[model samples]
Target chain A: MRNIRIAVSYDGTTYHGFQTQPIGNTVQDVLEHAIRMLTGEQTSVTASGRTDAGVHARRQVINFETSSPIPVNRWALALNSWLPGDIVVLQADEVAPSFHASYNARRKTYRYGIDTSKFGDVFERNYRLHYPMPLRLQEMKAALAHVVGKHDFTSFASRRSTKTSHVRTILDARMEESEGKLDIFLTGDGFLYNMVRIIVGTLFWVGEGKLSADDFKRILEARNRTAAGPTAVAHGLMLWDVEYDD
Target chain B: MRNIRIAVSYDGTTYHGFQTQPIGNTVQDVLEHAIRMLTGEQTSVTASGRTDAGVHARRQVINFETSSPIPVNRWALALNSWLPGDIVVLQADEVAPSFHASYNARRKTYRYGIDTSKFGDVFERNYRLHYPMPLRLQEMKAALAHVVGKHDFTSFASRRSTKTSHVRTILDARMEESEGKLDIFLTGDGFLYNMVRIIVGTLFWVGEGKLSADDFKRILEARNRTAAGPTAVAHGLMLWDVEYDD
Candidate 1:
């Protein structure tokens, strides 16, 4: 058996989520179905992480073991022929048999977009959260400054998260505002379920003057899910990139 | 009655087209429906021009006379409350009583996007034409230079057009290539039905070495629709802007 790794990008608006579900269509289900048709083998594909419904991914790494004799580099073109227009395979490579898409990941980056235009951008409505209200960018930046470095991240995670450890290290957190839009970028060693969304939600509150930079720090230290703001909508968030050791 | 002129933007993927149709919902139908709901008046709307199905508009000028007491500046906000997410009212103004959206237009600009990326762009699938094949940008540019100035563009217009005259002045024609995408921008005093799309299709053929720069001029002079290449798909085209005399 050979472990094949592939980088994929998808527009998740019409998908249920990255993981397979008992009901409704998902990115995983579509990929697996495409693979089954291509290789004549029913194989389970594992991803770096599962994204919520309506969350896009610029680059999501996944791995699956297959006994097919097809060249490793030809996997992307082969699978793309079977996949829908919303999902695209970027590249494919052969990896060591022990490599795992989920467990072997080193860091991940996520981006959240907020459209502040009064009338909103119609073409990008599906990709951004339309928050027409004015926001204090400097205050939001100050709040983000408190999010860097190691923290428990329990307050930023979803209440339904069942992870054994709530601790995570945030490598970087920053915001970019331009052309009536605000984008937040966060990079971390690992994230709990809905962690990035909750963090962005809290930052929005800070920008709205509902909370101060100090309050963001207190929320992080509180390590209580209820202490943080609500989770931002899934459509506004995107899994940008995942990094692995060379 | 006030002649309310509104600048609107829409993602046209879901609509039938810009004009009213008997069987399907169109941008005009939706706008009239929303206006009826907002002002309780069943009034028809006039646009600078009609765009085909799956074609987007960055700024489409439309006008409708209304007896509602709402302020001109408030029309945008009020109408937006009733419009769907894919369509937006950007601005509203009380134009001259005799001003017409279609008749008063002086010039128009249309843009067509061609994505030359290897795997195509999933996020922009609806907004661009995915042509992974190599294109000769210089050759395409040389062909576009022949498009400028006045010409009888019967070969570029759709055969279904009933216009008496085919002469039109192209103010400018240019191409921009970057990041694996080539964008064609054409500004003209006026265009016939599917003129921009047909021109783009012919340019694609030129880029692929199927046609030469001199052949394009010859085809324009041929004064026959069949002399030109096939009409490009509607999804890659956008009504970028329109101009009217003050």
Candidate 2:
């Protein structure tokens, strides 16, 4: 069997999430079903990370083993024919047998989009968060600085998480505005459960003048979920990219 | 009664077209209904131009006479609250008594979006046309030059058009690529029925090596609908802006 690596992009509005779930539709369930139909083999695919329901992905990475004779490049075309319109396989490539999508050492990037216009965009309602109130960009930037380094993000993590480690390295965190959209881009070695969403919520509070820049530092030092801001909605969040070491 | 000019935006997937149609829902129908809901008066709203079925609008200008007590700016907010999620009123202001939405327009701009990636973007399917093959940008540029400037666009127009004159000034026509999307922007004093779609189709033919640059000139000079390329799908077209000379 040969291991294949695939890059995917999906509109997560109709999906329950990236992982397979017992009750609803998921990106993994549909993808695996498409692979099974293409290769006539029941394949279990693993992704680099699992995103929440209504969270989109631009370049999600996944890997699986298959014994089918179909060429690697043809995987996208074959699988796409069976997959729904909301999910797409961008590219497929052969990888070393030892390669694992989740264990590969590298960084990941996520972006949360916010529409700061007084009026919401009807066309982009599914993809962006509409915040009618004006945001203070400078204050949001000040709060972002506190979360730019490696630290224990227990305060930002979801209370339901079972992960043992609360420590993660954040490579960059920046807020950019263009064309009536405010985009928060964060690159990190990894993230705790709901880390990015919690961070965005905290920054939004700072932008709204509800919290100061120093409040972010206090929350991080507190290491308690109650000290952090409310988590933002999932639709505004997107897994922009997943990078794996060559 | 005051003549109010309103700027509107809509996702046209559910509408038949901009004009009031007998069978399917139209932008005019929705707007008129929303206006009636805002005020007890039954009013007639005239748009700057009629877009084809399934065509979207980022900014469509319309003028209507109303005796309602709602302020001009408040009309937008009020109508938006009553309208469906697919349609929105961006701005509203009172216009001169002599102003006409259709007759007073000096120029209009339309943008056609094409997704040229091998794999289509799931999020933008409703807003863009997916073309999997690689496009030759240079060839497209060569063909675009043939359409710029004042000329008779009879060949690019629909055979069913009732316009008396085919001469229209094309202020600008250009193609731009951004983030895996190709945008074809056209600015003109006016357009014939399906003129922009036919132009895009002809340019796509040139990009695909189906038609030569020299052949485009001959096709334009033919002054026959059969001489031009097929009309592109309507969903990818957008009425971007309308410029009125004071």
Query: Highest DockQ: which candidate?
Result: 1
The lDDT of model 2 is 0.91
Clash pairs (backbone) in predicted model 1: none
For all predicted structures, in order, the TM-scores are: 0.98, 0.96
Stretch of 10 with least lDDT, candidate 2 chain A: A116-125
- Model 2 TM-score, 2 decimals: 0.96
Candidate 2, residue A209: the lDDT equals: 92
Stretch of 10 with least lDDT, candidate 1 chain A: A134-143
Model 2 lDDT tens row, B1-246: 889999999999888999987885899988999988888778889999999889999999999998887877688789989898889899999989999999999999999999987789888888899997888888888888888899999999999989999999999999998878999999999999999999999888888889988888889888888988899999899999998986
